[model samples]
Target: MSRFTRTQKILMCLIGFFLALGLLFQGMRQASIGDIGYSVLSYLKYGLIDYPLTSIKNFASDFSNLWKVQEENDYLKEQLSMTENYQALYENAQREKRELQELLNMNESLSDFNIISATVIGRDVSYWNDQITLNVGSNDGIQEDMIVVNSQGVVGKVHKVQDSTCIVKLLTCEDKSNKVAVRINFQNEDTGEDAQSEETDSASRAESVEGILESYDADEGAYVVSLLDEQEVEEGMRVVTSGKGGVYPSGLFVGTVKKVESLENQLGQVIYVEPLSNFQYFDYVSVIEVN
Candidate 1:
């Protein structure tokens, strides 16, 4: 046979080299394909598909929990609002209860007197001329000069009256027309005199130490009681109406003696009286109708 050409010989050697190389790597290529195929199939079944399903289930559970939390918050808000309303109502009830109790006590104390209850509606604008207006008026038998009193002591006298309202001049009034006849009450020792006596005699016997409720001392915040006679007056002594002028009834409490001093250009002592009623805060009063 003719000698093979140079190009043909080179092509045959290249093909033989590739054939040997392929045989040497044939086991490795098969093993790699088996492992890669198993890994790709597992990823498609579990990693690609099951991962999204698990995430969806978790999202649904979280959303349900969020709704439950929102509902609980709303319930708490409603309960808090109800609690606030109950607290306000309880406070109002307590205040009303105290006011009612005070009115009951006042009624029991002044049971013997002929009086009509009235509510204070207004107060004077001036501090010097202390005055208060009441709801009761002439229609309710409330007349001018009628004595007004509270549970503690005397409040004032009715100054003006209308069909449905009346104005009262308080004890703190600086006017001379507001003077009240009062007396210091003393414990009378039984002298074995006849107990049964005329009404006029009993009235005279009731007055022990007499004085005039004249003026109010603004500096001392007390009413000035000018004694009609020279008598021993001490601090803490009780003073009441004497009924000498027939305006206020006898035995109506006026005030207590806070201090005593010598009068200027007068014979008797000047007794300073602190009124029993709180003039600044009284709400209710009684208008007296003398029997």
Candidate 2:
């Protein structure tokens, strides 16, 4: 309408009027006038009324389905999130129960001592393997040099204490200053003595060797136990605290010999001991003392 001139628009209207007249006359000649009128009415009913109504109905149905689908999706997502949370909680509870069982066994083995159980609450990032912090502190009868142990063996002594927390110095500390008096319980028994042995432990009849666990090889994950003098330290020998120097108690498990080598200038034998304690993963420990 905008592009057409006023005269062109008038001409188009006239031509449409003539074409309608011709069609009307032709229909009137071929069919009854009433039938022609009825056909036009039928076209108007379908095109103007039924088509629009059906389209609106279909659109409403599709929109309702889309809304229901969105709601179901949201509901499923929420359920999945809740399930994940429950699964995590269940796993944590199982782990706690297992740790408690281990601690119970440890307590039975150390029934002679007054033991205070504590959770490992923190670790120094710079000295992760060397030290761990416990939830127990001086307020809970804790003090410096208190012996800390897990189900496996000696963890470390309490290095520092506060009102609510204490730091433990592990045997994996960088320096050799924290040496333990240890004895190697080896299977060097004579064949005749072994046949006569009644003890379940193979080292029961074997001769033992005393040494100092003064050095640690971090890369090898073993302790360098330097004997007083050159002696044949055999592999697979178990080491335990010797209870000398009034430091560690007798028979507390230390580690086993991974290998044995000679010291500098062959002055003594260097026994590499792999500890029983899993240094990477300990959650609970006990601070022990003589009753």
Candidate 3:
């Protein structure tokens, strides 16, 4: 009923033929054309609308997982910091325990003597005249002339005392008044034995070779023993306080003989002694109150 060119009419007929063929094929397969159209519409709706909604849900789930992971990382860092702090505290406690044990052992060794424990506070700046300051003073029963000793050996004598602190004149003091009566402990010459002999026999037969500690030589780093008895003194001999003058207690360790020299005209032997007390290292000492 419409006016059209011949070519246009021919194209319209061809389209109608293909559409009829598609409907006929669908009917043979027992599927209606309307059902086919509805299936196509559902596929398009899923691609445009449902698929985007599913993608958004997946994105939200990924974001939540990422946030949880970050929180866990932060928590682990905090725990690591706490662990390091605890480790440092544990090490410090162990060091303190060792120091206390050493102090206790030293106290036990001096159980027979009346002692007042004190800590070294400082040292004299002069190298020639060695001295140390103690934290105890007259308030702690400390007084001048009190003998100061440690686990190793005698340290010095209290020189001056204050209300809370005191100064000790070390055996190395370069003063003649600081002399101490010392004796060399030698093995029994009659038995012809060495230092490995029995304790009782050695003690009974031991001869005390007397000497006077005069002064320290800063250049030689040793104490000079003057007025030594005319005895057979040797190197490596143990020296101790003889308690002759009543200033220092008997049997307090002094040092060991490093060398012995003959005096001119055979007056006496000059013995050089290395002190047992290590002035550079000792931190705690006991002031003996001889009863």
Which model is ahead, 1 or 3, in terms of TM-score? 1
In terms of TM-score, the best-performing candidate is 2
| RMSD values, in order shown | 9.8, 13.1, 9.0
Q: In candidate 3, what are the lDDT values of residues 1-291, reduced to their tens digit?
A: 669989999999999999999888878777666788899999999999999999999999999999999999999999999899999999877755664566567667768777898888887567425788999999999988999886567868999999999999899887777899988888444443444556566566537688899888767777998755577788888888888968898887888898889878867778899887454566678898877
Clashes of each: 0, 0, 0
Where does candidate 3 stray beyond 4 Å?
1-109, 127-129, 188-206
Looking at model 2, residue 60 earns an lDDT score of: 99
Top model number, lDDT? 2
Q: TM-score per candidate, in order?
A: 0.61, 0.74, 0.60
Which segments of candidate 1 are over 4 A away from where they belong? 1-103, 125-129, 186-208, 264-267
**Model 1 score (lDDT):** 0.81
Query: Per-residue lDDT for 146-210 in model 1, tens only?
Result: 88887566778898999999998888887877788999865543344454444456667544688
Candidate 2 vs. true structure, TM-score: 0.74
**For model 3, which pairs clash?**
none
User: Per the 3 Å backbone cut-off, how many clashing residue pairs does candidate 1 have?
Assistant: 0
List the global CA lDDT of all models. 0.81, 0.84, 0.81
